[model samples]
Every structure is written in structure tokens, then in C-alpha cells.
Target: MKTEAVRLYGKKDLRLEEFELPPIKEDEILAKVICDSICMSSYKAATQGTDHKRIPDDVAENPIIIGHEFAGELVEVGAKWAGEFKVGDKFSIQPALNYADGPVGILSAPGYSYQYIGGDATYVIIPKEVMELGCLLPYKGEGFYPASLSEPLSCVIGAMHANYHTTPGSYVHKMEIVDGGKMAILAGVGPMGLAAINYALNREDRKPSLLVVTDIDQGRLDRAASLYSVDFAKSKGIDLRYVNTGAMDNVAADLKAITDGYGYDDVFVFAPVVPIIEQADEILAFDGCLNFFAGPGDSNFKAPLNFYKVHYEFTHLVGTSGGNMDDMKEALEMMSKGLDPAGLVTHIGGLDAVIDTTLRLPEIPGGKKLIYNHIRMPLTPISEFEEKGKTNPLFTELHEICQLHNGLWNLEAENLILEKWNKLT
Candidate 1:
């Protein structure tokens, strides 16, 4: 089979090319990739190339495809796994393969390590290890974008589950954030931060009594509030507040004042900035758990922590990069129950746009840049659909459909794109 994909050749080198895919082995499966959500990690991989741990050292000889947050339909099921998986089934992959013998060993993932498989391709051969490790997940969601987005949602789900507290004078740690406790997410108006806020509000098992989301951009904070409304959060029994720390005289003092000087029980740092990490540390209550959710591109990234609190006030810290299989399943389950992640996506593009989008992801503004693998459209923001509609019929229909759903992408918009653009395949 022939597939079109964006392949990484070396540092800052990405090429969108059409190539022939080898036949799937009996232990492998053939699939059609429909859509993928661009991630910052992909940008990092494309920038670092062979220097990336998940990318093979010989990537210059055999390039790997780029993208991981993807969902698609099964096209051909290998005989070895026909009973468990069948053709025509919709699926999403938990790309953190964690396999010992994968292309790049334990850190090997679909988007960063494999040659014929990745989210940016029209077709792919799923390796046997993916199924054996239970990373090939069946997604029964309405649209492929939600399934693709589940990977990112699982990350936040894992972070929330990873937070823990302790009882005095014991080695045993209680898992999960404090139920009905004060929580804060510093620099939390970005894409991943938005996911964290959504998960925290919609989670059924436990919830914070007060949820404070802080960011430096007032416009982004306002947009976040509009998407995840304070009224809706109140209905879910959460006191949601959006704060622009950029406008404050003292960031830490103003944030702590929100909780009546008691500080917060769970604090999540969403930005790699040193001040934001320290701000997260400052606003922690007794026995507070600080989750450093952002991964810095710099190896030398460091932030000051209150050792006095660590020894006397029982403050602690933990960091997470990706979600486990269980977290992916939980994200899928939440979507099945109608937890919409559309708020995270801000732009849409296609296969032709993958190379430039992946290389310049950090420079682009807005949220997730969702890609339809079979299309040939440019990367266009959802907020600009109406403006672009003046000269294009496709954008006109897209703008009308998005307007019906509060200017967010939905199943109708997805169906329109697939129906109209699949001819480009």
C-alpha cells in the first residue's frame, strides 16, 4: 500500500512525501488514518530529530512519521489478531508503546519511532506489539477527532490521578487530589491547561471545592471562561475562577488571597517558566501536592521550591509526561459519556499542511491544530472560518456548522470535512 505522510529526516527536517508501505505481517494490521491532532511533543521531536530519545539514531537513513494523537478505521486485520480486531472498526492508539524491543526501545512511540506508521499518514501498518500491549484501543465515539483528542485528555487524567496526599507520621500516601479541597492551575489557559481544567470539572469521582485557573493572557483566559463557563462549573459543584496573573501587582499574593490565605491543596503548573513553577509552589496549603505538568524543552530547566515547606509543611512534587493505558481508557469512557474536548481545538488543516505545522507549532497561536489526513487544505483557524468564508464555499459551510456549536468543531463539521475532502485521497 502507498501512504502519504510527514516524515522527519533530521533536526528541523520534515518532508511530506508519498511512499510505498510494506505488506502487513500476520501479526500486524493495516489501517486508514482519518484525523490527528497536532501536539507540541511532535514539534519537539521534529526540532530535536535524532536527539529525541524516542527517535532512532538512524532516522536519517529510515525516517519516521510525525504525530501521535490520531484516530482512524481498521482497513485490514492480520490473521493473528482477526478474532480480537476486525476490519472496519474505528480505533485510537495509545502511542506510548513502552515495549522493550520497539524501534527505539522502551521510549519508542508510534509518531516518533516507526517508519510506516504514524498519525500523519493516509495508511499505516500497526505493529503486533501495539495490540499485545493493549495500546490499540477501539473507539466508539461519534467522530475521529474526539478519539484522537483522547490521548491528550488521558494525560490530564493521569496527572490528576497521580496527585497524592498523606496522613501524618506514615509512609503510605493517599492517591488523587483532595476531594472538595482548593485547587489551582498556574498558567493554565493554554491547550493542555484547558484539558486539565475540563477534566477537573467533569470528573465524577472527586472534585475541588474551589478551582482557580491562572494565566498571563487575559484574552485567552476570557476565551477559556467562555468555553468552560463558570456557571456550568457551579452546576457541577465547583467554584471556578479565571485569573489574569499578568495584571496582578503580586502574582503569588493575589492568588493566595483567593483562598483566604489557606493556600491550595492541589497545584498544577502548566507553564515551564520558572516564575510559574515557583508560583505554584507558593500557593500550596499544608500537605499540598504540586504537580509540575509542563515538560520543558531545556534540560537545564530549574525552579525554586520551599524546602522549609517540604520538611515542615509536608509539601511535595511530582511530574508526569504521558498517560498509561488505563488513563487512555478512562478518557475514551468519558468521551462516550459526552464529555466534549472540542474546546481544545482551535485550528484545522490537512495532510499537505503537516510539515509546516509541525515545524512551526510553537510559533502558531491558539490551541490544537487538528489535521484530516486525506485532505489538502491549509492550516486555518476556526475563529477565522467566517472571515475566510467570503471567498470560499468550503469555509462558508464550515463557518455555518461551527456557529451552530458555539464556534467549536463538532460531529457535523467533521462529517462535512470528511465528505467534502476525502476525494483528495
Candidate 2:
């Protein structure tokens, strides 16, 4: 089979190429990728190339695929797993494959270490290890975009699950955020931060009674409030508040004042900035668990913490990078049960736009940049669909469809774009 994909050759060296894929072995499966959501991790991999731990040292000789957050359909099933999975099964992959003999040992993942199995390709050969490790997940969601986005939602789900609280003088730690307790997300309103907000509001198992999302950008906070409305959050029995910390003189003090100086039980830091970390630390209640959700680019990143609180007050800290298989399954299950993650996607593009979009992801001002693998369109923001509709018929229909759903991307819009652009390919 022949596949088109964006491959990383070296530092900031990415190429869009069409190459012949080897025949799938009996233990392997053939898949046709539908869509991939561009992640900052892919941008880091593209820029750092071999320097990234998940990237192989021999990328110059053997380039790897450049996407991970993706979902697709099965075209052919290998004989070794015909009974377990059949052709035409919609699926999403949990990319964190902790296999010992992979290209990068336990750090190996689908989008980073593999040559023919990344999410950027139109077609891919799923290796036996993916099946053996059970990372191949069957997604019964309505559209491909939600399944692709489940990977990111799983990350926040894992972060929430990883948070813990403690009892007085007890050595054991209680898992998950404190239910019906006060919570805060510092520097929230970005793409991942929005995902955290969505999950925190809609979670059926456990949730915070008081949810406060903070951001320096008023525009972003306003956008988040519009998408996940205060009325909607109140309907779910949550007191949701969007606060712009840029306008405050003392962010920690202002946040604590919201809880009547009782402080917060669970605080999540969404930005890598030092002040945000310190602000999160300063506003913790007793037995508060501060989850550092952001990953810093610098290796020597440091932030000040109150050792006095850590010792006497039992303040806790934890960090999470990505989700495991159970977390991905939970995300997919939630989406199937009508948890919409459309709020995170801000732009849409096609296979032809993957190279530039992946390389300049950080420079782009938006949420997820969703890429349809079989199309040939440039990266265009959904917010501009109405403006672009003046000259383009495709954008006209897209604008009309988006208007029906409050200007957010939906399954109808996704299907229309695929139908319109797939013919061009």
C-alpha cells in the first residue's frame, strides 16, 4: 500500500512524501487515517528532532511520522486478530506504547518512534506490538474528530485521576480531586486547559462544587465562558467562574478571597510560568493537591514552594504528562455518552497543510488544528469561515453549518469538509 505522510528528517526538517508501505504481516492491521489533531508535542518533536527522547537518533536515515492525536477506520484486519477485530471498525490509538523492544524502548509511541503508523498518514500499518499491548481502542463515537481528540481528553482525565488528598495523621493518600470541594485551574483557557474545564464539569464520577478557571487573557477567558457557559455549569450543580488574573494585583490573594480565605482543595497549574506555579502553591487549602499540568521546555525550570505548608499543612504536589490505556478508554466512553470536545478545536486543515501547521503550531493562535488526512486544503480558522465564504463555496457551506452549532466545529461540518475535499484528492 502507498501512504502519504509528513516525516521528520532532522531538526526542523519535515517532508511530505508519498511512499510505498510494506505488506502487513499476519500480526499487523491496515488502517486508513481519517483525521489528526496537531499537538504541541509534535511541534517539539519537529523542532528538536533527534534531541527529543521519544525521537530516534537515526532520524536522518529513517524518518518517523509526525502526529499522535488521531482516529481512523480499519481497512483490513490481519489474520492473527480477525476474531478480536474486523474490517471497518472505527478506532483510536492510545499512543503511549510502553513496549521494551520498541525503537525507543518503553518511551516508544505511535507518532514518534514508528515509520508507518503515525496519525499524519492516509494509510498505516499497525504493528503487532500495538495489538499485543492493547493500545488499539475501538471508538464508537459519532465522528472521527471526537475520537482523535480523545487522546488529549485522556491526558486531563489522567491528571485528575492522579491527584490525591490526605487525611489527618494518615499515611495513606486518597485518590482523585476532592468531591464537592473548592477547585481552581490557574492560567486556564488555553486548548488543554479548556479540555480540563470540560472534563471537570461533565465528569459523572466525581467533580468539584466550586470550579474557578483563571487566565491572563480576557479574550480567552471570555471565549471559554461562552463555550462552557456559566448557566450550563450551574445546571450541572457547579459554580463556575472565569477570572482574568491580569487585572488583579495579587492573583493568589484574589483567588483565595473567592473561597472566603478558606483556599482551594485542588489547584491545577496550566501554564509553565513560574509565577503561575507559585500562585497555585500559595492558594492551597489544607491537604490541597497542586497538579502541575504544563510541561516546561527548559530542563532547569524551577518554582518556589512553601516547605512549611508541605511539612505541617500536608500540601501535596503531582505532575502528569499523558494518559494511560484506562484513561483513553474513559475519554472515549465519555465522548460516546455525549461529552462534546468540539470546544477545543479552533482550526481545520488537510493533509497538504500538515507540514507548515506542525512546524509552526506554537506561533498559531488557536486551539487544536484538526487535519483531515485525505484532503488538500490549507489551515483555516473556523472563526474566519464566514469571512472566507464570500469567495469560496466550501467555506460558505461550512459557515452555514457552523452557524447551526454556535460557530463551533461539529460532526456535520466534519462530514461536509471530508466530502468536499476528498473529491479534490
Please provide TM-scores, in order, for all candidate models, with all chains considered together: 0.99, 0.99
Candidate 1, TM-score vs. the true structure? 0.99
lDDT of each prediction vs. the true structure?
Answer: 0.94, 0.93
How high is the lDDT of residue 384 in model 2? 95
lDDT of 1 by residue, 296-368 (tens): 9998888889999999999999999999999999999999889999999999998999989988999999999
What is the C-alpha local distance difference test score of candidate 1?
0.94
- The residue pairs found clashing in candidate 2 are none
